[model samples]
Target: MFNWKRSSVIISASVFLLTACGGGGSSSSDTNNNPTPDAELTAQQQALTDIANAVIPVLQNSNNQALSLANAIDAYCDEVAISSANVASTLATAQSTWQAAMTAWQQAEVMNFGPSFDGGNNSIRERIYSWPAKSSCFVDGALVDYDDDTAGFDINSQTPRRIGLDALEYLLYSNDLDHTCSTDSSTTSPTNGAWNIRTDADRSLARCEYAKIVANDVAAQITALLDDWQGAGDNYFQQLSTAGSTSSRYSSATEALNEISDALFYLDTEVKDMKIAEPAGISADCASTSCPETVESTYANQSLANIKANLQGFLAVLNNGMDDLLEDAGQGNIASTMTTDINAAIANIDNFGTTLVASVTGINEADCTNSTSDNRLEEACALHADVKKVTDVLKTDFVTALTLAIPQSAEGDND
Candidate 1:
């Protein structure tokens, strides 16, 4: 289950967007093909609809980007790579490139990392460590140890070690932190020697957990921003609902929006700083020739896992916290300014489905705890275009829309 609070931000905003259209009418842009009703809505409807107009597109792009990136990684993994060194090199390159991207992002912004940005210190254990022996993100009812396609065999079966490795490493933005697969089953259990590229003991699992620490911290940052906005929304609403004149709503909302704007900018800064990097010493061991690559990988996996656990824990907490907030809303604690129609818009976000997230299960491969940097270098690439997309939209388009929807009243007083 995705954290409801975080998820609700989208839903709440989205709901407002949906109902914000002109009173009785549909969008002015709808070529429709099928034109429906037409009439100006109340101030509230206009407001929500305006918000929706700006929000949904951002969500759609960001979510899809993440999914696309995951699928690409899975597709690459399905192709049996040329060799272990090749996989390692690929991992190293990707790791470096992605880190660069993160750095570039952070550098481009003015916010602090792991702090002002997104709770950069929160650790996410469950998010990163997945037991291939027991998990469920697969489409088929049950899954095999590495049987990515239980009933159907695709090109992915031939994937290289690196692709699987990267996916394992970056589970933070890719996998559904909530409702993680229920169990891990495979035709060839890695426990009984099926631990090669398709091992039941994947090392990157630990990396993912480690990354969760960063991701969770980032999520915290997101939640912080959301809270700030909600508070601002409340203030703005208070003025609108009880003021003798329209001045209070305009003034309060303007100030609140300014705070929200800062939060959004900071969120961008935080995300940019989240660097998905390999630990200091990735592979330090490996004198034994008899040691299967899988065994070496397991050692590496464990090592990274230990380093990342603290952060992962916090990630889970962030998710839980947001989920709790959503639960509160479910139990009837929404704002009076919000309408049921708006709620439905928020619900629309749930409609955003995922395939890569559902089709794959955690793969068991190299171990992390005792593996070497040379060995632990295994990598996979997850494109967080979706999350990035939405984040970008929140930063850009939504701001513009909100400004227009909640324009300052001529009679309002700011002092």
Candidate 2:
């Protein structure tokens, strides 16, 4: 999901104190001679604990869904390998399961701190869902190499670019043997050309085996992440919730808040810039009115779904985690406004066609580059603008009120 060190740049902390800290209403005890007040539990501290509590269940559910996705992928691969009679149904089921996993993953994206961060040289996040830098050539090469010597081809040995969600997407949505390694792309090296001459059955079986291997690897990684969070004793969740304690990673509740707040910038950068603007050709990299090839999930036609999932994830962070904090800060109205704006943005996308390619193609054919007329492109643009409004509030009002740090990559990126 996150490229870790590559995309992230270190930025100095910018903390703002906008409003006075508001106190939460305390409950009175019925029968107590002299009950000691929980004076140490401040509003900020409660808010941090609330966020941690809200997040734990979501993460556990996400882990279960990841396992389910792995099972589905493995089952689909097995059917494909044996040329089963129910291959079509199995593939469809696998696609559905993948979407479910993607939804859960998106929800967890806002919490992409702490355990999700890279440890030393290991990248658990990329091992699960490497995008933008995905290399289909690596997948193609792996398939070809597997065909040559199945015993020598190990999917786990492949780099992060070749064997995550994107690789699985390539294998599941695209036809068998469709990917090819070429010399033109610098992201991946060209492999042996032997696969080009292989029989259809051979290529399909090879791809299926590779997909199975990737699924197993993904499952193991996801389970490890889950275990780190709440599977047993000495979990990260306890450290996160018990901030300021000697055992906690964070020395203060604000540090925990900053981590979650910074993670929300994924919506501002990746969702807004890469997913929406890049494909719309509004990004700096594109000159045309639209670039369908840059769109994520182009093969599956699930770009809109991805956007919806992202917004939903953002909403989850606000409602489940940040609402109480905003209320304590006497800025509950901001949360209400954000909820309304985000829901409206989602509805705008729903009004537009879900298939991004089809919508963009229609806009291109009409040559409605600058037209203000009520058309698909205009609708899409309106949705983009609406989402930008939400982002603006998040970066400015939300972060400033919460005194949260903006991610370095997202800093100064007004787009």
Candidate 3:
């Protein structure tokens, strides 16, 4: 969920580039004797090129999903403005569209280097899906101040917390019973009692408008990202596949490999540690018990699905890009082991009895320790251990076999 975002801190590409270039040398005469053909693709180079090619279509599909989500949100907002009677059905459709987009987003998260990592000030990734720092209070304030002309607030001016997928979750799924408009003017505000005394319909309309703005922003940002990656002449995909070329960001094939390999740590740090361990009370952040409120997509009850999507994304990157190279390097066992670990982790998440929130909501905090006999807590602990196995292989054996350096940002993250 929100945990994945923090794991994406930018690493210095120069360090990896220097390491990659250190071992390679050829004299001018040697190069002249055997001028490498422009079209020649070494095993590692070919694997990276193939990965770049494969990612284009995956990103295209994700952009399409984002567009669909934006359209569905707009449609739902339009309907809410007209008739409140079918709000439930319309909201359901909108939520479904959001889920589809979320699925694609989770997949794209695995490939979160390059275009997604803007330097300094602003980040495209944050614009699309800021979480863990989500603030419903900000969303509530935006809705309450929708008509405030002096505030000059629109979705564009809203903070990350107020205008991303999490905000939409709050608007769509929270307190569904009170979502409908009430004719009575004395009803309390759904978000907080201090807000204006508007009818339920008024609140719904405001929330719908905010949701639409957030959806449109997400769609626009994703479209721009896709363009940066695959657009006509300004394509970064070519830059990635052509590492060591003058125009590419990476100075060697191994540098590019390092970037992709570093991305795998997201599964270890964010998914296993922040997403599951913190909530399961196995990590330092959670001192004694499961923290249901820390779970992502809690309002939508889609935390389990998010975890599965993350594993699916990780598997895609490994299978599509690294498997053949690993086999050729005599490290095929590592790939197989990682694949099995990811699959088993997905199964653990699937078998977890209920929604993340429901599973931890009423459990005694004292009984939520890692060794507690509580079935739900125990299952959660087991899932964390399972994911750790995958990370251990990737961070240690995989990096060594490939001769790739772990990104500095990911170093020393013992957990």
Show the colliding residue pairs in model 2. none
Residue ranges of candidate 1 with Cα displaced over 4 Å: 1-41, 71-80, 92-149, 152-415
Top-scoring candidate (TM-score): 2
Clashing pairs in 3: 181-201
Which digits, one per residue and each the tens of the lDDT, describe model 2 over residues 34-82?
3233423244455555555545555656667667877887787788778
CA lDDT of each prediction against the hidden true structure: 0.28, 0.67, 0.67
RMSD for each model, in Å, please? 20.6, 9.0, 9.3
lDDT tens digits, residue span 1-415, model 3: 1011111112111211000000111111112222254422355556666556545555666677778888888888888899867777878899898887787777666777778867422567767777667777666666655533424655666667667777777877777524222332323444445334556776677778767777888888888887887678847776776776644588877787888887777787778788877887667887656777788786888877777777877776676557656666666778788877777777777677777677656555454454322244456666667778888788899888777887776688777
| Alpha carbon deviation, residue 93, candidate 1 (Å) | 6.3
Off by over 4 Å in 2: 1-41, 120-122, 146-156, 183-193, 362-377
Instruction: For candidate 3, give the lDDT of residue 195.
Output: 38
